[model samples]
Target chain A: MKKWSLITLVGADQAGIVAQVTQILAADDCELGETSMVRMGGSFSMMLRVRHDDMDLGALLKGICESLNLHLHVDEDVASNCEETDPDVNITVYGADRSGIVAEVTAILADAGLNIIDLETAVAGTADKPIYIMTIEGQALQGVDALTEAAKKISKGIELNIVPIQTLRA
Target chain B: MTVLDILQYPDERLKQSSKTVEIFDQTLKDFVTDLEETRLAGPGAVGIAAPQVGCARRLVIVDVSQLKKPVDNHGYLLLINPEITKWQGMEKGREGCLSVPDYTGNVIRAESIRIRFQNIEGEWIEFDSGGYEARAIQHELDHLDGMLFLDRLVSRRSDLFTRKTYKK
Candidate 1:
């Protein structure tokens, strides 16, 4: 029976990382599924889902990671029966970089029963005066109006904009 | 009126550019009726295109009045060989398509537009539109050019999103 597993690799960004890693998987006849690889702040990270019958795949990947000085983790993929829900609204926050911005903003969302599906935050502007910007895609369980009201609770100086996502079937 | 079958994404036919509509005969008008039926049958669909229904012709239907929220719009437009003659400003908005039912994406569209097209009688008409109505028109027009919202994603990683299962 084929086994489903998730493989994660993280290390210093370098060329040929994908080629080297995929070559090992290809030799084992693993069927690749969804994969995401990105370079973040001088570090390269990869997450791959694969289906294979080979039980020794973990050892082979571990050997390769050790030789290349990269961190690797392989684990069995657990299937969840829960249906994935789409985000109903988008929330964007912009303010001077300060502590507790994300925590405070997320707390308000939680209070309104919003489930965050995707979030990306970045600090921009000058080194001395950084601006924090966070964009959140969330499932609004309590409707957009409730989410909007909850956003009002956020502290002053931080700008928050909530736009309901309109789904057009065209 | 017949409810036409909508062609899903990756069908290859959806990618083919549609030909311009030349004749404004009764057959063309009948097809428009079927296309509108297909649109109305969709869940909250505000617009539709001929290519989406396996007809590779430059025809589209847009009616933003169906939306619960009131917005500036031209009620029930039947546009043939539509073209965006002028446009200005840009805004990023989330968009979903009937062809690509599994995903939605953030797409940057013109905030306002000046467009020209023909009616069922082949009479040329031009007008300006903005807001959600403009976005809907742009989306349906893309079908004529074999373009999907996936082609204009704001960001591959951040902007593209999986759609939720449809209720009902």
Candidate 2:
């Protein structure tokens, strides 16, 4: 029986991190699955799924992590049986930087039964006049109108725009 | 009227650039009829291109009259060898393709355009279009040059999204 494992790696950004890690996996005959690697705030982070049959992949990864001064975590991965829903709307919020922006916006979505499938936040502008921008791709379980009405509760100073995703088959 | 087969992506044929409609005759008119039928057969499709149906000709049909929400649109357009002479502004919008059935991507397109094309009768016509109609024309025009929305993705990582199934 093949086992699935989720591996996460985080370390200072440097070249060859992907090449070094993937090289080891290739040599071990580990089949790689869904993976996401990104550089965030001067740190490189990678999350990947691997399928293998009875290999000490964790020990090998640990050795590489120790040599490279990186952090690694591996855990058994179980595929979820839940039905997947596609996101139907895009939520954009931008305003003066505040601590509760994400919290407040997400709380409204949760109350409205909107499931956030993807989210990205960025801070821009000068240090003194920082601007917060957040974009969320969400599945509106309670319909777009319900989600829109619920979003009205969001406080002022924040500009919120909700656009229903229109898919054109041309 | 016949409904033509829409060639799916990776077909190689879809990547081939289409030729200009030089001899517009009964055969071209018949093909346009079939293409319109095929577009209507599709779910919520607003426009279709000649190459999509395996005919490598610079022809496209667009009709935004039936859209749920009212917007500025040219009722129904059947264009041959359409060309965008002028365009202004740019905005990122999500787009899906019948050829690439399983994915949607954010692509930046001109917000408005001045276009010229030959009607089915082989007479040249010029018009200005904005909003959804302009976007549809741009999308179909890309097919004439063998370009997909994937080719114009705003960001490879952040812009592409997958759909579980192409709703029949």
Candidate 3:
């Protein structure tokens, strides 16, 4: 079976993390492709896309990740199986920070056969006047304004905005 | 005359400052028509700035009545030599450019604004607006000053794509 893998390294920040990660990838006979590493809020988060050969792939990867006290998720050849990115439709939701905001929106989009392509959510300002901002991308199954009117009703109590966005071609 | 083509980036016309709408005459009318036409010719465009159409004039046209925001918008206003008199609220939003097609960037601007501008007839008009209408006016006005929404972006932190939604 052809194996295309995505390895995510998320844990506490420390030295040798990157080196250890590369070592693990090399040992797994995987070809490393693109990578993004960030240290924020006192935690190190790194993600890499890789292609791996067969022979005890999943269990082997789990062992290495467990030893390092990290969580690892491996998807085999998913990109080659389905390489197309989800079409993005930009939508904004903001209100007083509260629970279930993401679930409410995602559920509505989910019901409409739309996938949450990407999401950026933040709670800003002090706790007294905390502001919640969520920017999301979802794929439209049919056409324009398909989810808009329904969103308008669900969005009344909350501030919702939608705009079509096309990302940079890389 | 024909509708002026909306100049894309890397074009020198887009980099230069637009001329002021000195006289709101037939020539100016043609420019406004071209701006509207160019705006209509593309994907749903909320606004256009004069510099985008190769005219370095401080003129812009905006209409966000079609947006889903709940607020008052004055339909389409052909602004010649417009100015912002009052502004409030702060927001970081995702914005796209008619000049720079196929890319959307993040931009932050005042949430509301009171603006003064000259109509196509050279008569002065003023407006107090908020929500998407206010955002469209700000985006268009930025064009009047040789600015693209890209210039206002805080960072590449957020990009808008209708289809390619996120970094995976």
Candidate of highest DockQ: 1
Report the C-alpha lDDT of model 3 over A1-170, residue by residue, as the tens digit: 54677767787787888887788678767777756777755678877777777655557667656766776666556574434354546677778877888888777766665667667677777979888878776676644366665574464457776665433110
lDDT of 2: 0.83
Candidate 1 whole-model C-alpha lDDT, 0 to 1: 0.84
Q: Ten consecutive residues with minimal summed lDDT in candidate 2 chain B?
A: B159-168
| Native-to-model Cα distance after best TM-score fit, residue B62 in candidate 2, in Å | 1.7
How good is model 3 by TM-score?
0.58
Query: Measured against the native two-chain assembly using Cα atoms, what DockQ does each of the candidate structures obtain, in the order listed?
Result: 0.34, 0.29, 0.05
Calculate each model's fnat, 2 decimals.
0.48, 0.44, 0.02
- Compare candidates 1 and 3 on lDDT and give the better one: 1
The sequence of per-residue lDDT tens digits that candidate 1 reaches over residues A1-170 is 88778888999989989899999998989878767888877889998888888577668788778767789888785352224356778777889999999999999888998899888787889999999988888888898788788877889889877777766556
Model 1: docking quality category? acceptable
Predicted candidate 1 versus true structure: per-residue lDDT over B119-163, tens digit per residue: 999999999999789999999999999998888888734542223
Runs in model 2 deviating more than 4 A are: A1-6, A26-34, A49-60, A74-86, A126-129, A143-145, B156-168
Docking class of 3: incorrect
Q: Could you tell which candidate, 1 or 3, scores higher by DockQ?
A: 1
Q: Between candidates 1 and 2, which one is better according to lDDT?
A: 1
B144, model 1: CA deviation in Å?
1.0
The global C-alpha lDDT for each of the candidates, from Candidate 1 onward, is 0.84, 0.83, 0.70
Looking at candidate 3 chain A, the ten consecutive residues that score lowest on lDDT are A161-170
Q: Rank the candidates by TM-score, best first.
A: 1, 2, 3
DockQ, candidate 3, comes to 0.05
